[model samples]
Target chain A: MHAQDSSTGSLIAHTESPWRLFWQLLQRDRLAMAGLGILLALAVVALLGKATTEWLVIFDPTTVRLVDKFRAPLSEASALLPDADRPLTGVYLLGTDELGRDVFARMLQGSFVSMSIGFVAVGISIAVGVVLGGIAGYYGEVRIGPVTVDTLIMRFTDAMLCIPIFFLILVVVALLPASIYNIMIVIGLTRWMGISRFVRAEFLSLREQDFVLAARALGLPAYRIIFWHMMPNAMAPVLVTATIGVATAILTESALSFLGFGVQPPFATWGNILADGKNFIFDAPWLFFIPGFAIFVIVLAFNLLGEGMREALNPKLQRR
Target chain B: MSTAALLEVRDLAKHFALRRGLLGRPSGWIKAVDGVSFHVREGETLALVGESGCGKTTTGRAVLRLIEPSSGSVTFDGQELLKLNAGDLQRMRRDIQIVFQDPYSSLNPRMTVGNIVGEALRVHGIARGAELNERVAHILERVGLSPDFRHRYAHEFSGGQRQRVGIARALAMAPRFIVCDEAVSALDVSIQAQVINLLKDLQDEYRLAYLFITHDLNVVRHIAQRVAVMYLGRIVETAGTDELFDNPRHPYTRALLAANPLPDPSSPRPRALRGDVPSPLTPPPGCAFHPRCAEALAHCDRQTPTWIQIARRHGVACHLHQNTSRQGDDEIPDG
Candidate 1:
């Protein structure tokens, strides 16, 4: 009755689909807007940084300059000494790293790695999680032979969760050849438990609702019922989880790379850049500060975005 | 009523298994619908009336196989419904549909009104494209909704409008029989009349048969051609609407009639039945109604009553009705 009265009073139900309503709600929240703006800007920068590596930076990120090493930003390194080798690169924007690689260029290039790892890893996690979690959740109590599907999947998920995620990633990465794909897979494989549990909880309740019974009465096949009717209804929580999971995945990739087991050196991941900066923290703090700050901003943006999405998509929150 | 029954149910029972304790073993069963038998003739409305847990809703569902009946047979148009395979049953669903109890939860929230109504047509491959849209719009109008409302979601509609939409969805299937499961219970009194009139009009026009399930006896007096009163999952009495209203035979049926509120305060009023209904989990041993029956005897508590035909179209299950055959009475007219 309330939804009906309010629906006619406003154009919320008439003009907009739930998704569009969610967007409108998100747009109204300044924090969500800021989060969205940060992510968009970050995405643009990462893409532009990756695409224009040759034209924009001109200096190859991996190319080392021995004399330019440890140069403070915007300095003509040892120019007054007259015996110093002429700097090969232009003025270092954020200064050169410990290896004399252009910190700005490397950071820009590292964004590509960080962004891709975040997206691809999250995508992988979502794909695996949605399917596995969907099955686990939708068929939670259903049994196959001796094992209940929910019990089997959840038990396995619990076992996976028991292993500290980072340690699990380390063990897997240690076994497999360290590569971008490997890190993505390991992160994806280790991160689906929460999503599975969320989807299962949603399914447990949703499957009992009258609409689901109505769907069945309409004689819709089980697959269509689960995917079309139930999945969309269950997706609000999953979307929130995925949004937050993206940040977690990115952090994991960063940690893995910083520990020398992630995307190999010379690829210039933000993690390895931070790793490269760790040793030179006192001597050249810019190396540590630049990449460290980027990670902080990106992670914070995703978290805020996740929080906003949760509120916007939530009917209870958005109804007012 | 037509001689050809569109739907016939015989001893259809549904007992939901209840699990208890940690291991979740089957502890007991909820006898929601037990030995319910009835028929909905072509173009006839059979109202199955009962209290909340008496299983009128369950009977409606079992007839459609929405919830599979535990035991018994349902024959629709001479076809054994329970014996049909999945594909056959699905195809059979076209002939029989249900308008659910809650208008809010009946329609899928995510779907447009058009999709909700047109889905039956689309799924059955009965109509498509502009024809689908036209049929949906026409049915919408038939239910007193604007054709333009098809683009809107169910949440956009009032309870009355939503119930209309629910009716329209069932109507779209062009079904011969529909189980109106408390279809108008959630609406306002004024809206209830409008929906009832619409249902009446639709029935007259399309010759649609409806099994109107409800707890409202007053509504049954207006809509039902025949009434079946249920108590603890059993049909205690069934008769032509006028006969059941004027000369109710079963004690449970009398109790239900007594419970109906009379607007005229000056008339003598019968006291309502006392005590909450015994739980369906463990109904009283003999006749389920004996515990609450005012006319109960020692034999009523010891022996289950047989369903006896008291009149041409009236059936009553009670110990009082059983003695008449012994008296060699041709016409009791007991009331």
Candidate 2:
């Protein structure tokens, strides 16, 4: 009896919780770890930018000096501003743009804008996707005249997909006033189709599960069945989609700003700064290269994180 | 047993329409449950037995209105379930519960056993807080699980334990009738007996009625008071457990019984029915079992046989039993 009790104790001890297993799986992938590290560092940078700009006035992003214009990265600020009444201190870390504003300060401010747009846009898309997808999948069989709820919603999604989204965003953003909120809303509204499809597919399969049927048989309301019972099961794919979606939203915002359709001037977004550096690309490559590299690294980080999450969440791919 | 019927299903049918082309045009109807009729008295077990895709599961689902019946009457305690509005039907579900076949799929993997069992109580506003936890603990203990096990998720348990969680979920509502749809079919042979005995004990303790649907004949013989053998989409024979096993009237019922595996190795294997079950999409015109029935008559292919009562609580829908009926009326027999 004592031996049997010990054996049972060992057996119980061996069963790891699902969350711990997911974390363990994620940790094994070196590329995913690199991605997570990059994203965490960028998040800290974005938060620091917000704090410095709003509360502590650390780096002045908008201050301009005509003498310091077109200074290469790591150039001496004192050398550029010699014999000045207000002599600049330290080195120009990432150099100055054509407008003579500090590149490092602008990049820091841009980090905050890019990160906020990425999150808020993805949040909007996830909300729209889950709602539309939940309705489509759960009530897919319910027919209205010739078309089903599934058919109607999916066809609308297909129609949205058919349009070249960038051009559509270009036209809409051109018509609307240039603001960060407008950019976030437009990118969010257009990019939700893929997430919706993921959610719809998840719901379609999940609704037929016996647990869902059991929930129904237990006299739970339709809302409870959809949100409480089915949504949690459908969330893994949605999380992956939303992670990738943040990257897409960030890229789109950058592209829109580059084309002069995104967040307007006075706000130093990466895209606008890149747009400013376009004419002087050869003379001051760091101005364009710095923001360009930032965008690339952040997007790649999010994509890697999303892929890692996908593999970790999938039970078939999990290692014992 | 009580003479009053707790649940009565009359001429229940569920036809699934096969869609074709991009527009989803109706190509054909698969009559999954065609004119199935049965009842369960208070605390009685009525086993609906059939092979896979024979509509026994569908019948049970339709009776509870889980999957809506195409056309039929399901009267649960004299309340027409089909006619009830959404809210009323939902309210009515508290009394009628179901235990599913696959233990792995029947439970929410994310939920703790306590939440899975206590969700119904919270949803119906029956209990909350400490009372809810106490109830969940009590129900868990009743299903032969430790009260401490309620904190664990469904993935931590074995197949038998998961099934017990399912039963506890159903039993939490204090339901009068439960449709056990292949409840033990997914468990091991050794575990099957334990679940069956647990179900039996629960029925006696709660006076719960069960519409037990399964293809396993041994389980039916062990737990059921009455057995209904289905062929194609319709019930061919239904009788008392002992009467059906001792004297099966229909050719389909006999073939099904003969096909049961024997423990004795030296015993010659009984000749099983020839050919597969006909597809419900396009079943044979007359009796659906004509192609598979060994004693098929020429008229069996051209005309359908009417249901006839051979004795008290014994009925068969076959041409061979057409002439041996004590009650000559073509109407379905009611208890």
Candidate 3:
């Protein structure tokens, strides 16, 4: 068994045309590499970002220590730490907001929300879309509701596409109860139509592929043939789409929050922070600048990664 | 012919409703396999040879019940193929295996060769664990592959190797009647010969019957014990391999022989046929080949010729071959 495992590994090493080869080529791309490094670093920051809020001065964000209203950023910066009113130290580096709340702590905490929302929402959307779209394309007449729901689902997609996305989101948000979970659901559910369409087309082409037919002829179950045998080859486009989809979801979440239906008050969302800091743009530019810059950097990283994946997945680039 | 007919296809006709018109009324029909009939006795290679659009493939598919025939009976070991339900049909499919053309595309690139062959075994609950792996390795060896090749995927192997894997997959079930549906048509000439020779050896060793479908007359002559020549969805002639080549009664069969390019350049120039076949959708009213026939009489266009016994173990369907019954006196093989 040990010898067999070694031989198999070596055989794969010899013949494996795995995505790692393509990703290695992508790692050579300086801009993409930098972008990926920044993205990964940001992810780590998001995961660890909550720890910063826990350690520092985290008074309730809406708590009114009414005396310190409209205090300037640098001037009140020293006052808000666990160590009260000490001479300038490492504590409260970015300083206090008008509410005597540590803005830097809130900002750090806020990142967890942003990245989590972006990651989970996008992950959910991709999961739903890839499966739904794959089935739609791979097995065209597979049921979405009753009696070959393919035509109905497809038509619904067209109708949804025709409706302006912002307005559609507004209607959905209006009818639905307010919550971050609901926000994620709305974005994920709506976005899946594109993936389904893309996946469906991929499946249609792939189902006719010889390997898939070979799998069928081998008497493998339809589900196994569809998911296991066909999905890997058909999913290249969906992968690229999913990468870009993360950025889109993040941007959309930010927009919804800024428009006031998204992450509600008391939650330290970058969108809400950006919304709150909009009036004080000139007075305390750091508030808007920080969230704005974070969104920009993260979105750009995703775009870079997505573009890199597109190149990597391209069959034309597969051969030397 | 052997006593036990492993696969018997009688009066099989697969008609495709080509185009629906006028409130879903049948506008036309494509007689893909029209009244086609043949039988494969135990451990015998029965070749179905014809040109493109001749429905030889259709006959093979119809017999397998891959495409449901409009009207026919396919009896494999005395069981009606058409009467079987989905589960039974699926179960039956394991016994009647097929090796498709274009070996390059016949394998799933994602799967290793072991899985490709072992899939059938796994599906049918034949072997598992160390035993399964051992069986797969043994099967690979049986098809002239190294045991190490099992770990490798299809894309890693060449066309010939992939075909060997295909054969291994088919033989994994230990089937009785294997359908080679233009199995070697896509291979190089040398490779074709290798596969052909391998198939013959495998058949001999396993005592497996085969329905070898091909357009290549030379290959039919080489491997087939008996050959059925199809034309426009009908078997125009069938005879013992030597008898068909030596005395081809049907004109269509003669034209097919003439059209085949001779391997030897020094041989007499091969006689080429005139014009392409008519579409199956609007086939000629009576005898489908009458328009293309060189010796077509007025009556040939009006009436279809009956498929009759011309000689011992020989049959022909042609207006010209009516005198065949009287001309050649021999004991005709009773159906």
Identify the superior model by DockQ, candidate 1 or candidate 3: 1
- On residues B1-335, what C-alpha lDDT tens digit does candidate 1 reach at each position? 66877888888899998974345567899999988888888999999998998998888888888788999889999999999999998888878888887888787778898998898688778899999999998998788877778888777677888888888888887888889999889888878888888899989999999999999988999899999889999888888999999998888888888888888898778787989999999989889988888999888877888777777788877888786743322221111
Indicate which candidate wins on lDDT. Answer: 2
> What is residue B206's positional error in candidate 1, in angstroms?
1.1
Model 3 stretches astray by more than 4 angstroms: A1-13, A17-35, A54-76, A79-103, A134-149, B17-29, B326-335
RMSD (CA, Å), each prediction: 3.9, 2.7, 4.7
Model 2 Cα lDDT, one tens digit per residue, A106-225 = 888889999899999999999998999999999998889878899999999999999999999999998999899998999999988988898999998998899999998988988889
DockQ of each: 0.37, 0.44, 0.26
What does fnat come to for each candidate?
0.30, 0.46, 0.21
Worst 10 residues of 1 chain B by lDDT: B326-335
Off by over 4 Å in 1: A1-14, A54-59, A76-89, A140-142, B20-25, B267-270, B325-335
Candidate 3, position A152, lDDT? 61
i-RMS for every candidate (Å) is 5.4, 5.2, 7.6
> What tens digits encode model 3's per-residue C-alpha lDDT throughout A233-255?
77778878888888898889889
Q: Which candidate tops DockQ?
A: 2
Decide which is better by TM-score, 2 or 3.
2
Candidate 2 structure lDDT: 0.87
Q: TM-score for chain A of every candidate model? A: 0.89, 0.91, 0.85
On a 0 to 1 DockQ scale, where is model 2? 0.44
